[model samples]
Target: MAAYVIAYDVGTTGIKTCLIEVSGTIKLIASATEHYELHVLENGGVEQDPEDWWHAMSVTTKRVLERSGLPASSIQGISFCAQMQGLVLVDRHGVPVRRAMSYMDHRARLELKEGIANGIQIAGANVFKLLKSLAITGAVASSVKDPVWKYKWVERNEPAIFSKVYKWLDVKEYLICQCTGEFVMTQDSAFAALLYDTRKGKECFSESVCTMYGVDMTHLPRIVRSTDMVGRLTANAAAYLHLQEGTPVFGGGGDVSLIGVGAGAVEPGSTHIYSGTSGWVSTVVSRQLVDASAMIAAIVGANAGTYNYFAELETAGKCLEWVKDHLALDEINIYLEKKHVSEAYESPYESLYDYMMDAIKNVPAGSNGVIFTPWLHGNRSPFEDANARGMFFNIGLDTGKTEMIHAVLEGICYHLRWHLEAQEKKVNTSRVIRFVGGGALAPLTCQILSDILGREVETVENPHNVGAVGAAIVAAVGLGWLGKVDDAKQLIQASARYMPNMANKAVHDRNFKVFKALYKNNKKDFLLLNAGR
Candidate 1:
């Protein structure tokens, strides 16, 4: 009988569990999903009950184990990958003191601003402090506020909870504690939390930084590497998940790092692009590279042995879904029917995208002097400004619906290109791009990306499940079934490749300049627009 490993991916929207064979083949097992609402309060506050996450993870793991029919002993180990930067506080007895704040939550904006005003420098070094200051001032919302501020917010607003809390952690650490009854943190996660010293690869928490915000480092968990087994499943947790007591549980990193490993982008200079509800561009870096201006830094990778540099476009598939629902509901079947058809040629009754692509093909690349900024959900990385809104420039009567649609697609591609360029400048490497997620299935979009970036983009066979698979790989390593993460990369198979169309390179290059200028010209306008709110 073959042994199997269970991996859980705790996402922002839901939780997914997978049972995989030691050889890296996924078995058809049960999975569970639960949705939690993002409670939005006044003044940009967002919170969710931490219990909701626990419930989702527990039920989902049990469901998968029951469906697999493997005896508890046959399961070698368990691992987890979670959304990064969300904060959870647990009291001394291990009960959540208050609702956990989601990464999207901006409730602590004022607190962060005040911290900067009072000269509360985070991470000490001038560069890190500047980044933190930028974040507090709302210059870059998502990039600036991390779990640290959330912890500080709890300290100030819920002093009772703060006094009672014994351990403060990201969502992954909190869930793992529930499983193993151990208090620990992963290096990759800690580094991304902006609470650890990334330069020395040490678990040094800044006392000055914490003191400035009235936070005590004693509440933080002991830091561990991503590959280390932090603890074992306790009898209680075993009863809850149908797993054997003492099953080893490994410390895991954030989702972005795991996603890179799952997509077979473990090697340095290899890039992975995932488009789920949101989109991300991640590449493996051997060293921590910091860019003061771009807001790009090296964070934890799938394992402690490497670093992962990530940039994000806040909305990707979400925008597409919005378009599908609002503008192309009646054309769903038509679009699906033309999946494999080349949209290069114009036909009188071509598919919706075909018409759109043709309309833009003649628009002299770059949407014919038009630029669209994709800040629909607010910018995530590179430019972390949440107040930024999407815009279209160089539009005229000649710009029809198809042209507008094409411009939107081009705008997204250009945003990604901007990140890739910035990353290359910081790291000085030419990496092949691996495109994954639901968006990768769109050949036209993939080709457009290739044309814009002047690089080949390959699609993985199982983009949607890569994160789950990567989590399983961690479990396999913990079980000693795999020697290293790279060994598990053999499991990933490329389904298709999108090579750049050189013919359109010059066209895209010329338009890229205008696309690049849109932000500079409209930055003040966006800030002014947000002031009205």
Candidate 2:
């Protein structure tokens, strides 16, 4: 017997809903994507309306069901893999008080400074506060983008809304609340807040740390496991999504926790790199660890008793998206003008990227001495600097569009390599890493990543939907269609493998040194230029 589950991947820019069929193996049936807006305020605030997320989910769910030609009753469960560390405050009725603050929102600098950056410091955090956090939760809320500061920012600035807050939820929790009319946060999502104690047998919100941060413990919600059934669909949500009123809703995790599951990196020490709009290098580990200097931490995973040593790059494929809009304007206009040509492609960006890949295929490994910094939206791992910006360094008279475009791809790979090596300093990373996400669809990217990282890069089938597939796996496990989440490793097989080419090692090595030096040399300038903006 086959069971159907719809997994919604709620991301930074949009919502992707996938209908997956589980029988002997997991298979994707139909999928639909609907984009929403990310409002970027001048004050460094990034937000999206919770209504926009609901709208996209509704539209995409109907579209997926329609395309699959399946009745709503066929779906046994619903799950989600969403962007983490976002702050979604809702009232007692489960309605958002204001626009949801994005994970990228770092407007809480003042709150961050006042809360954790004031006294004697260790790695930019107050030493006393850092020690207390480490003792209690094994991690600290060290970044401005952390949800606690955002919570404080709301408490200090928008007290009226803060007064009405019932619970603080992440992006998926908000969606889950809408689906089931229940207020709960998954264990992995709770850990992301840096307030959850992940120690064995003590997996609950840390009262000491929460108190230290001045957060009202009551604002936190009850914690549930990724595979636990939160609740059934409510009548209102069912009507909006055109589904059954009581479909079981499973507690799927965030992208960082579950994408590796879909990548088949389930065992400890298995690593996977995700290159989406934002990119990250995550490794499954048995114990929690933190490298305060590198801004890397082993976050709780969706699977029980596991953690993901995670490092992130804010803009990965987004760099290419920028290139398409800004650099390839003429090509984009041409593609749009040719209506039939555009319709022939699946994704709107696919044709443009094909043109780009073809254009830069001949460019050499190092982009002819040109190196690009992929900090278009600032960087997080290996160093935390909100003021950093992206630029192309060492462009000469001989430089061409091909070299520049190729450099962007190389720069992204370089940053990923930096993250991989940083993780290696504390934990042993996989020699042959699994690469997943829309970016892995490109053979050129896989090869470049391999050449840059000096490791074998393998990609799985339907790399773009790994997040949704992970969510589906969670649903399958919860529904008893599968025994456990690790069963996905047997179901998922590698589609392609790219081995490192040692011939290009010398050039990449030279360029990488300069790449690291670029930030060290110009960080002061970056702060000077971008501060107070």
Candidate 3:
């Protein structure tokens, strides 16, 4: 028997609601998306209203259910795949005390310096504090964007909001509370706070870490497994979503953990790369590991007794978005002028990228000696520098916009290669990588990524919705429709495979060396120009 379920992929900028039918295989029935505001504060803070998340969820859920013609009673379960490391402090009634802080928020620089950057240091973090954090949590709050620093920032600056804080939650946890009225955090979410002890058989909040960071332990919520039935939908939430009141809600996980399941990278040593607004390279492992020097660690996995050696790039596809807005503004205007109004059914934002790809595909492998860094919002893995900014280097007088755009894509792949190499140094990464997220929609990107890494890259059907698919898999496993999360490998199949073009290896290698050196050569300048920016 097939079971119906809904998975809400709540991302940084929008919500994608997917309706799926689960049995021997997962079938996506229908889906819808709704965008929301991401308020970028002048103080380097990024936030979004919790009400916007709830509104987008309600709107997209109704749209998907309507498109599928499935009654509310037919849906068996609901779950979420959301952005991680966000801070959503809510009151006793589950209402947010202020706008939810995004994972991109880095306004806690002073707090981070005071809390972790002070005293004797290693890799720009206090040696004693780093050792204690790694011994307990297998991770450290070394970045200014880390959630603990944001928590401390609120406590110091917004004393009134902090006073009413009942429990701290991430983006999906807040939505879970909205749906079920339960104050809970999934295991991955808890570990992301860097205050959770990930030691085997002792996965919970660490009192010593909390005290060391001056974080109030009471602000943490009850931690739950990703597949556990957290609660049932409340009447108000059900009415708002046009669903049944008692629909079971499972504890879904952060995108970093669940997207790999959707990509069928479930076994230990399996690896996947996700490129969306943000990007990461994740490899499944049996035990926790940390490479403090590289700023990479094995984060708690969605499944028990599993961990993911995760390396991240804070902004990947975002660099492409920057090009679309700034470099290709004229192309967009021309594209809009040439298209008929009826053809507007297709999104101009997407079609414009397709048009840009048509232009970039002809621009040779090395972008004509140009190299761009995909650090528009700074970098995380392999280096932790909030002051780092994106730049186009080695652009000769003959270079054109097409070559620069091609370099942006190559730059993203180059950074992924950096992360892949870092992960390989510590543990064995997959020879062939599963690539997911919106970036995989482009065959050119797939081919370029394959060429840059000198490995095969595979993408599954509806690659953009892998996060939602992973959430649906979690729901299926929870409903007994699937044996376990790893069983997802039997259901999802790769739609396309991109093989590396060894012919272009030399050019890419030359560019890659320059790409890596750009940061090191300009680190001092980046600090001087972007400090406090």
Candidate 4:
């Protein structure tokens, strides 16, 4: 009876599918989520099986469609937004070569260091190479997470696997190829390669830049705009998704840009903070920018002729998950004892956050002088360092478990403030920021971020689904359901705002000073400090 679009978001931890109806007012009909595993190696290698992502997409789509009770033909289009910077290599037959290298993977740090050692030209490239790259792409990351670096790593480390590669693709491109048999990537996804000619204001893979990254240009996929029709649904994919054959599919982009739109950050300089498995502070802008010193960059946005300035802190909501997995289990027994339920066997994993929050909610803002550093796998934003380790500093005899847990929460906000400092230089992020992500669901986190930023942090009714909503909005615009790029912002209504609590300002101010000093003072030869590091 009404028109609908299926928006699927493939995030670091999971795949979330949303069936959204656009009949005068945009409304979510049904939603489903499926999580996969991240294979973390001791040597800083991080990967995920592509097949697992496909399987999750298959199941989640079918389930969401079933719950919506809409006919397959009624769904007008399907679009996607996926985690950025991941490498998903496929062969001539479109089969994944091996486990995909996640954005979190830093196995190519050796390559990054070698490039930096060459000179101050590009910091990671020679003067000529740096000028050419900056002229075209605006930003270039020589880190292991760059798709180009992943290719170089494969060529050097796994020659056999590298030889079979037919194309170098990121998560969004791989998923698009999987759906329609179209070996193409959107400009937003192509931005991840740091090999695109962005200065042209036209989307195309740059051969010269690819050569600079030591990657073969022939292995790259074709580029398209985010709103362009990649292709119709293939019969097999449609069947698996329980949707009509030949359903329109738009060329969706990376999560960073899509989330900016979904969070109503379509206006230039409209800022938002995202926290899922990985996190960042981003703002939509009309102009191109690059700051090599601070490691922040502005690439093309999900919408045409716009850009998004993204500064990542690497970890946000992930810190919460880490605490849950490692520390919350012990709190379960404490909860049992406090409640006098005699359920000693109770697993803390089952309400991990609630238990931790119960303790954290009661603790003071300063965590009673306890401090936690969130560099659990190192940091990538405001600065780049791979040898840094997560630390628990300022712990004293009086510090309790609750104080330690509260410090972890505070520690995440502290890093976010540091990220904001860099973002403010390029964009005015001093105003209210839209906080959208899985992390925004936690009231404590919202309040902490607001207090730390000294501004308003707002969340919508469906904070976690904003990425999927943004993808759907892209399709909706292409389908003529929406008039302009900014019109889609109305779909998400901000229902709550967390204002700064001045009561904790003085304490946080003192702690923020120490937070910066902790990183500065602990600067050491990490290789020598921990040989296994």
- CA RMSD of each candidate after superposition: 5.9, 1.9, 1.9, 2.9
Worst 10-residue lDDT window for candidate 4 reads: 337-346
- Write out the backbone clash pairs for model 2: none
| Candidate 3 displacement at residue 105 in angstroms | 0.5
Q: What is the C-alpha lDDT of each candidate?
A: 0.70, 0.91, 0.91, 0.81
Candidate 2 has its poorest 10 consecutive residues by lDDT at 337-346
lDDT of 2 at 137: 82
Model 2 gets an lDDT of 0.91
Tens digits of per-residue lDDT for model 2, 151-264? 999999999999999999999999999998899999889989999987778889999888889989998999999999999999999999999999999999999988999898
Model 4 ranges with Cα > 4 A deviation:
114-117, 121-125, 334-351, 530-533
| Alpha carbon lDDT at 339, candidate 2 | 43
lDDT of 4 by residue, 1-533 (tens): 45799998998889999999876766789999999999998877889999888889889988987898877888899999999889888997779998999988888766665543266655445666667778888877655566667667778899999899999888878878878998998888888778888865456878777766677888888888888888998998888777888999998778998988888888887888988877888888888887766778897898777788888877778887888667765664544333454344435523546556765787888888888988887777776777777888877888777778789889988888888888878777638889989878788889988888788988887888888888988898888878766876666678899889887867888899899888778767554564344
lDDT of 3: 0.91
Residue 353 lDDT in candidate 2: 81
Candidate 4 residue pairs in clash (backbone atoms < 3 Å): none
Could you tell me every candidate's TM-score relative to the true structure?
Answer: 0.83, 0.97, 0.97, 0.94
